[model samples]
Target: MNSFCNVKSVMRSMFSGFIAATVILISTYAIAETTMEKVKRTGVMTAGNSGSYPPFSVMEGKTLLGFDVDLANELGRRMGIKVKFEVIDFKGIIASLKAKRVDTLITAMTKTPGRAKQILFSVPYYDAGLGALTAKGSGILKPEDLTGKIVGVQLGSSGERYVRSTLGKKVKQVKTYDAILLAVQDLKIGRVAAVVNPIPVLRYNSKGAQLVTTPVWKRRAVGINTRKEDADLMAWIDKHLSAMKNEGFLERLDKKWFEG
Candidate 1:
């Protein structure tokens, strides 16, 4: 009877140990399987963008075309996965990425300290600076000229940050727009004295939009953004971006989208 009781106790202990080990193993695997593995397993990677920013991302009829679009396709090709884009509003794009509605953000999103806390930014893929656009002959030659004038800027953009932080009390009123293009429209109609946005965007639109792009402000680096937990995906993107830079792919993109 004593031998039988010892045998039963040993069996119970073994079963409990096995259950605990299995639970730990499962938990470990769950932590190890991240977005990188998901992308590889599903054979698809979805990129998020505002879809309104031209030269970077824009909609032509029903099709999306821009530098960011091409870059996303290139990334997918390199990764041997199909790529798709989710056109989220500019203000909501980051939230969409955080919610895992998209695998990455392919918008020309700048890296800011504030944004760094919420998401991971890959190695910079592009560089740009803030530009102030005014109607021709508006007499706004420098930053000081914007004092006491109503200014328009895209909501949640680096341009908005500059206006709020640098031009704070100097400007009369700040008007936020969903799309920078709309702010340009307001500028054309005299709704705002000036529109602050990315230099590349302002330069592209100034050609025949009856607008002038002032000297660019401080430079900002634009990078691919992913959820904080998707560090592996972010690193993977950085590696490919390095390869693209080395092979002059980025230069080609610059020529196609930015250069004259």
Candidate 2:
């Protein structure tokens, strides 16, 4: 009888432990379901972009459209979500992502070593080099011509970094606007002798402006940005961009925006 009693007690304790384990598993699964369900239920993925940047993002009257916008829409379609564009300043894009104001940032942002620490970047979707645009017939022909000249750049951009690093203390730096177009405008008015920006952006925004470009530096990759810990979303975006590159979708978009 004593042996039977001991056996029964052990059985009861084992059953209780099994029940607790089951409860924990169920709770974990419930939490995961809740997190993933929000994305599908909402049906819209909010994307942050600097709409003032041409070729990558811009406002065509009331409609927001450009390479980044199209790419965001394509990503949403692949993810089975509708896309909602939120135009934000370039300088504040990372802040907005951290604050959860947008799901992702698909602006023409370079994948730099410093930014990699703060945000998760999807696989590179494009490659661009740093370049300077000067008024046509202006004496500034090469990177060296920028010496001792006032150069305008978008605040907090790689363009500014390139100029500072390359020109050292000779070039006067001006942070006029978040958009490269404004800097180009300043260049036209002789406020700044040259405007430094991504080669594609400067070309896209230069319409009727007497602008000529000289390559200053190279950026190895450009990528979409998402908040840290968004691993699933980042993985999905990486796969999607990879497919776009493989299927020639990216090339088509590039030609339409950059070559055309």
Q: How many backbone clashes does candidate 1 have?
A: 0
RMSD of each: 4.7, 7.0
The sequence of per-residue lDDT tens digits that candidate 2 reaches over residues 49-141 is 888888887888889888888888887888888878888888888999888888888887898777899998888888887788888888786
Please name the candidate that would achieve the greatest TM-score relative to the true structure: 1
TM-score of each: 0.86, 0.81
Q: Global CA lDDT of candidate 1, please? A: 0.89
- The per-residue C-alpha lDDT of model 1 at residue 20 equals 100
Q: How does candidate 2 fare on TM-score?
A: 0.81
lDDT of 2: 0.82
Error of 1 at 216 (Å): 1.7
